[model samples]
Target: MDEALERDCVIAGGGPAGMVLGLILARAGLRVTVLEKHEDFLRDFRGDTVHPSTLTLLGELGLRERFLALPVTALSTLDGVIEGQRITLVDFGALPSPDDFLVMVPQWDFLNFLAREARRLPTFELRMGTEATGLLHEDEDRQPLEEKAWDVDAAVRGLRATSPSGVLEIRATLTVAADGRDSGLRRAAGLIPEESGVPIDVLWFSLPKPPDPTPPTLGHLSSAGMVLTIDRGDSCQSGLIIKKGEFTQMRRAGLDAFHARLTQAAPVLGPVVGTLTEWRQVKLLTVQMNRLPHWYRPGFIAIGDAAHAMSPMFGVGVNFAIQDAVALANAIVPDLRRGAAPVRTLARVQSRRERPVKVMQRIQGRGHRVIARSTTGRRVLPRPMVALIRLASPALRRVAAHVIGQGLFPEHVHTGSVTPRGGHGEVGGVPETWSKTRLWHNEGN
Candidate 1:
């Protein structure tokens, strides 16, 4: 190895889970190093919905004020235009005071903000452009006392990563895999997820912003398919949900048919349909719903999409990943103070998260089944059902809002912090302008 380093904790994939975990751990005075393969968080089409649960977390961590300062759009309702009739699926406005809306910002902006805040902690180190290729192992002879007592044969030591300089071996007391669904470190640790088999995939692309200042509807559902749209100021971030493996058939039918499908789902986009002239402009998101039967093995643990890949049904993927981070941090911080967390301690993290993850997955699965039936002309929502929904809209909206926004067993930031930055602030107002979000570190001191 060209370079070798030791730390109390080392995390792979600086997405929401990894970044948040690193931040909380370092804030509590543990040395943490986060390895991110990408040089920057500028990628497009990532999950951008920062739900109420996460917004409340920002407040608990004293980051709400700073986060709200960013140019972000807040939506008080999750609505869908079904069969040309608008329906409010989830009413965020019915939630408790302050965090009664969902904030929508680019995923890159959120990640960048977390990274900047984490870097301010002296015990934290974020290495961009560093890719963790495999897990590091310790021989039985060199096993630590805790490993021997816990009966762990080959406890993971850290990771083998490749950076611009050269090969590097990181020796950490704990290693975390937060690299999303296709987590290489989790694979290297010989962990596998139980695939629940998702029935739909999403095609993400952009359309020119509409002239009307009113933000685009959250979702549009039709027999053709479902299209979710978000107004991103200059352009609209849109996704067309299709049956799994249907993209190939759509491509074979040619762009004209695809354009027809788009218009069928959301007529409001008909005017901008011509803007998407090439196939390259669209990105396919292969949706997967799965969770590792086990989230940890000795010193290594998988969190976020690495542990449980959530469906994008209600745009809850990002929030769940972040919740995993908070829950994991809360579970392991005390253990880290004593030394490396034991297998039992690691199991606590999974134990606390497993039920919530499974429940959400079940909910998403039911949603997919409905979408499947609807796309196949199965009359999933009869006229009577529509009337019933409208009748129960008030009560159903409150229930849906609580479930989707707060999530089941939402986590709080209990890991304590060294820096007394901004405390949890009220999440009431929207900025008049949203085009001024810059990296947190770039603002004037």
Candidate 2:
């Protein structure tokens, strides 16, 4: 197609990753456009917790105070439950940052904040209520097979539904897929993800704020699947973990039955459940965690849920998405300025994010196993196994601390300067080009 129709970058999906990336690129004076299918920013209970590592990134972007000033709840620490006892896991204070705690903000509000921020940048354009229908590609001049010649032209076409408009074809030097777990872009590109079996889904609901006598913070209830009570202070809401496909039955049983199940899980949550006036108020979400085989192909690159979708068990979805945005921004800025090869730039981003992504996957997988085992798996597993987890609550807390406080994905730690090296030659049996960057193995902050 016409080269004049293209832009510097086109982002699909206006979630945390897309918004942050648009802001970063626009600030750098690069032409960027974000296409979102949703017409508005209003969304229900999505991932709300922003971990410290993400907060640190916000600080680096000079947005810490602005972010913190938004309506949110500051959770100083996370508390886990095993066999009825509550154990404080991962004290945020231990982390070497002022914003150590997880900051809880409604997903809709946060996304709105990001969208508003993105609009302020002259180079950034947001096309809401529009969807990317297909991709367009331009053939690059072919080179020898061994020389790694690849297609250099691929752009996203967004169709707007509103009147006074025609098909808006946005060609970008690079296209980013931030479209989410069931990403149309990824599927359109025929990319498959490697799934890690972390088997736990969640049933989410928000009740009227419980009375002041109720608990002020969240806690996992050992008796009833994992319970998270988000006390807005005035009116609190609670979320309960349930088996996959259990939501339909719960909804069929009617609202009263669902409220009973929640109240039974945590009696202190009764006040919140009692005030539920409508069955439609409750929402159910199925959580899955998986990583793409490759984050990029040719002129396209995927980030956030498009690249990897993790369980909401640890509430790290938004945090990790924002982190991916930062990493992608950092990696691509130099390339955009230098007019580097598109494939090389995407490869650099994938390589830079590899270690952090693997680390997070492992952590999420472990957490899912623990929670699933504690709840539904208890019936199938031996009694000794259940007893062991209950007996080792302290160890579990320590593990949680390492995973949550230190960051399930520590991309921030990987952001320092790289040392210069000598001529291209074999070093320690590896090529000199590959050995230039040293991977730091610093464990435990």
Candidate 3:
């Protein structure tokens, strides 16, 4: 094995949660290393919605000006066609600004922006094309302890990983699993999410953004199928929701039948549905709404999807994941004095985030049932739901926007920048490479 590397914290998975936490901690002058299996952040069909809560956090970091300058579409409202009747689901105009509208930026741009900011700090190090194979603990079956600091008993000490070079070890005072729904770190730590019995999955594909300007975001619900269109400037990111384990049936019916069902739901797309010539462009996302009963064990804690796998409800996941990072930073900022945080310290993270996650999951679960039934027959809203929505009206619009945009308990940045441990002043001075290679510093064997 390669000689082990050491840091104050080692984060497995470089999703929003991991990246944000790494940035905050590094800014606090704590050594943090984030390992990502993927060499770059460019991935299709991933969550891209930057909710108001995340925007507010970015603003608190004093990075919002540069972030907002990026190519993004701000959505003031979420309008959907339910059986040809247009309904304004959530209205951002009712809320306050900067935090009012939902910003739809490409997920890669958002990640890269955060990564660049973290790179400005000397304590931050990100290793791409690196995969964590297993967890390391200070228990009976521990690896050869080359470092004296990790000799004590703890549920987790670090991680065993492999990269382009070879197998190596990363020893951290605190280990974080910010990996996604199919989290390798969570599995290595023996943590699994409890399913909330969701009944739908999504087939994601892209269509050309209409030449005629349409709503920045659109949701169309029909009896046969449901599809959402996200305006990404040049192209529209489309998602078709179907019943769980039903992709096979969809495929067996052929792309023609699938296209017909989807088009029937939203006739505006009739012109472009023909452009989806092949099935290769489509991808499937297995929907899940779940949370871990125990989010931490001694030296380790899981955050974001690693702790709670949310459905693609309102695409609020990116927001929640970022919120997790902010809350974690708030709870553990004081513990930076110690080489590793106390095991009991993780409970603060779980406790602060659990209620908000459960509340969101409950709403998603109900939405799944409603959508599933609608997909089975002629598109029709239940009478009670219609009556309830009509009665609620504008109030419901505001409530939905608040819940989806800001979440139950939004997080803010409280920790300030600290001096680097090595006495480095105002961490800067990295190479100025701009291409994909710029994302990683390849360490040779």
Candidate 4:
């Protein structure tokens, strides 16, 4: 067996949740290692919408200016077209200044930015091309029943992962499962998320922008279906919603039928729809909503999509995952600083995050139902309901803006940086150039 490495915390997955958690904990003076299976975060069609709440977080971290320096598209209002009439759904302009608008940047750029800032901290290490294989555990501590009360017979000590240095064993005071919805570590810990049914899937593709400037409307709905468009300078990233399990039928219907559907929902894209002539340009996103009844077990816990998968509704998945990391760090940094395991405090992370996740998932589910029903009637709202909504549009827009922009129970960065730049650091590891290999250890952590 390889020599074991020790750290204060080891995070599986290097996505938004894992990276944010690693940065926060490392800033608080704990040695943190984050593992990413991908060599880099360059994948496309990923979530790129940055809500106002996350923008506010950047300011707290002293990274707002640095992040904004990158090329980004800012959106201040969310509008929707129903049956031929345009209606404003959300007006973020009513919120406080500076961060009232939504920022759109490529997901890869955002992840890479977080990683660079994290590596500046002396206690942080990011391992690219490393994948976590399973969890590590030890028998419960031998103490009086009252002194050593834990829910499980075994406590998760850390995890086993494949790194460039062959089989690596990481022993940490806390093990985090942030590897996303199909988390191997979460499954290794024997935790399963209860599925919340989602009835629609999204086909994401890009079309050329219309020659003339268009309204800042984001969503278009008709009896035919729903299409969401985000202006990306020269191109528009469009998502066409279809009932779940219907991709096969869509393929069989031919590309022309798909083009007709896109135009039917959002006529503004009619000129550029022909650019998506090939199926290869389109990507399918299977939406899911689910959460674990319990998020922690003994010395380990799950966060982000590993604990609860969010639907594509409102584009809040990335922001919510980030909030989860902030909450976890705030809840346990004190315990870690004292060299304690934080087993008892792990529950607090779950308790603080579970309600918001559940509430958002519920709201997304209702949205899915509305879309599913609207597809059959060609219009999302009836004439009478439209009149009522138009009359109350001002009040409704403010409420909608607050919900989408701020989210529920937003968290602030509570942990402070412990080490200055260059003061004692092993920032980034040597880049690894190793092939995939499997190695297992029968010994427990």
The 0-to-1 C-alpha lDDT of every candidate, in the order given, reads 0.82, 0.66, 0.79, 0.82
Taking the tens digit of each residue's C-alpha lDDT, what string does model 1 give over 27-103? Answer: 77777889999999999999899999999988877788899899898888877676667778889998897889999
Point out the worst 10-residue segment of candidate 3 by lDDT: 432-441
Can you write out model 2's per-residue Cα lDDT over 1-445, one digit (the tens) per residue?
2112456778889899999887777656566778888888788788777777878776655567878889888877665544455556556766666866778888788888877665555566787887775555554232221233223344323211221244556656778889999997777665788887756677677766655443354655554556777755455556777776777777789878877777666666776676766766767677778898788877688899999897776677787787788778777765664544367778787777666778777877776666675456353335575567556756765566557755654664122222212222211121222223322211210
- Which ten-residue region of model 2 has the weakest summed lDDT? 426-435
* Alpha-carbon runs more than 4 Å astray in model 2: 1-4, 139-164, 212-215, 373-402, 406-409, 412-445
Residue 13 C-alpha lDDT in model 1: 93
Q: What TM value does model 4 have?
A: 0.90
Ranking by lDDT: 1, 4, 3, 2
Estimate TM-scores for all models.
0.90, 0.80, 0.90, 0.90
lDDT of 3 by residue, 135-173 (tens): 787653554333323322446778888898898798787
**Residue 186 displacement in candidate 4 (angstroms):** 1.1
